[model samples]
Target: MYFNNNLKKFMKENEISLNQLANICELSINTLRELKNNPSHNTNLSSLVILAQALDCSIKDLIEDDIATINFEKVAEKNKNNRLFIRQQVFSPENVQYLRNLFLQVGVPCNISSYGRYKTASVKNEYELSSIKVDFNLRVLDLKECTILQIVDFYVSVNQLLLNEAVIKDTLIKAFETYARKLKLNQIHFIIDRDYERQDDQYSNEHSELQAYFTYTLGTESMLFVQNNYERSPFPELEEYQIEWRKTLS
Candidate 1:
């Protein structure tokens, strides 16, 4: 359950900012920031209670009813270890369990050997998710090069998180859903095509920029002070957002 799809809508209607909402709701800015930014991040029911109360709505209004939504993800950064540094830390049994929990929460199946270190000096923490889910009633048909007569599932993969150009979380799930409903279109493809490569100044129309589709990089704490472009996504939270639509260019 993610608030990125719905929280912004409520905030917009109320004409509030994170700081304002934080003061009004008695919820810390940090917690509210996470709720607003990280679609992959979940919060406790108690915080939901405070938020629903402050927003004058129920918990359901905040995180349930996922119909007519746009999904958000982080385009993973490549593991450029460079073999320059061997930073090693032993994964505690509890640490391994926590990781397993996170994977399960994301619906990712992972293989972590509790004792595999003995089998070999090295092991890979690999996970593959093909046939990643798209919103059943996707709100946008923003594909760059592709056209379809009717709604159809576009096959894609969550190839292990790798670096991509840019990222913007889809905080406008409601808006996109409305757009999809009007156009009778479903599914959003995160294509790294010409449209995206082109700078905003290169286009006369801003909508063509593909701001809704996103890619992400691993962010650092120093970036925390950067002003967020809400028009982007409510994500790149875990710093792993990459969705690709493939084709053969002639």
Candidate 2:
């Protein structure tokens, strides 16, 4: 049995109520009540730490003690998909070199650099402001949906902006709009994560804000694909998002 159940047993023996335990643990009353009601519930690391401190027990003592025989399959089965992928485009050789120069100017330490036909480049830079490890990858791909001349990948977090987020976001929006209009891309497709979070339920604040996946149409087939995919999403809310207007390309 897990330590949560053991803890519950201990509490019962001590004649302590969940409300009293909540007060002692400095944990949310709802959280403590839930733990008592469902000892099998998986507590978050933060909550567990607080609870352990209140109980005068180490985390190890509160975790499952029958490690040798505990079945891992049950926990494994509960795990959900946790994949993070972000894709954006940078156009023009000037735009490409501009970013390369920007990073070069920063003089941040990086590891694992490479160059290829798509001109993929990856760098590791720890942000000075937040001291967080930020991995950056830039590349060019034959979007097949946009002109070969106008598609490049901009794969850095928006948080790395030297200026305010609003400024960077506006600049990006203008740049992407210009590229789409110039290339006559009626369809645009992008893959992005909603946000990064310590807990699945937690929001990805400024550290991880993104507009999510987008698709643009260059051809009839691509347009059809975009339409179908849009309708099939669990977040039907995205269907209401407005597409940037494209001026006729000469």
Candidate 3:
């Protein structure tokens, strides 16, 4: 669990400088910087109250729980399909460096991009066998069906140690919600693919046995509010199975 302070966003929106805010809150500049740099740090409640009063916003508006950094890139290639690809990466401060090292060790390329604390991977092969690719394809198809002609091929990938599936899902939901809200999108669509595979010892000991399902969501109120799961074989060529979700923001 992590908490994010929206001090930078609030400062930018209100055109308030760090010095000015410190003065307004009657706090030292070092203290303000500490709070801004580390929201998860254990600090006095009075500091938050003073900052909230100085910023003229509620405490909730300035702080949020389980906030992760998200980054996206628009990918398009004329030689292949005419679909646009939105490559997204999500991570938290604690895992940012770990993800970077993991990606490097896995030989995944980097595009030299950063958003908040997350960085983008340069190669699509990082998520080639993952359900993220399938979900991205589904989201692109959904947009085209909705008459969204300027659809970009969506390619999203994230680098993290294999944690519990539930934790990853929750992190993905929060990241997508932040991205959608950042773009001021009222409606979005996401397709989540969960891949399962097994080696068939009874059938010549081949590693061809596989099953997969997709969870679809057309979100208006919240990203994870409505979901429907369907069983299907979305990708057959991929060997290692991984699950992920992609969103179509409009």
Q: Rank the candidates by lDDT, best first.
A: 2, 3, 1
Question: Which digits, one per residue and each the tens of the lDDT, describe model 2 over residues 125-214?
Answer: 544333123354444344545332222222233333332333332343344445544434444333333332212211223344443221
How well does each candidate superpose onto the true structure, as a TM-score? 0.28, 0.26, 0.29
In candidate 3 the C-alpha lDDT for residue 28 amounts to 89
Q: Tens-digit lDDT track for model 1 on 1-250?
A: 3333367667887788988898888788887888777644666778888998988888877773532122211111121231111111122233334444554444434443433221111112244221122221111122454321111121112222331222111222223233323333333323211122222221112233322332222221112112221122234443243323211111
lDDT of each: 0.37, 0.42, 0.41
What digit string (tens of lDDT, one per residue) describes model 3 on residues 1-250?
4455667777888898888887888778998887777654655667778888888888877775444331111112221233223222232233344533443443433322223222222223333334321112212121434311111122232222222333334444444454434434433443333322222222211222344332222211223333422122245454143322233444
RMSD of model 2 against the true structure = 19.7
Give the poorly placed runs of model 3, Cα more than 4 Å off. Answer: 42-44, 65-250
For model 1, state the Cα shift of residue 238 in Å: 47
In model 3, what lDDT does residue 214 have? 23
Question: Which window of ten consecutive residues has the lowest lDDT sum in model 2?
Answer: 213-222
Task: Name the regions of candidate 2 deviating beyond 4 angstroms.
Answer: 1-5, 68-250
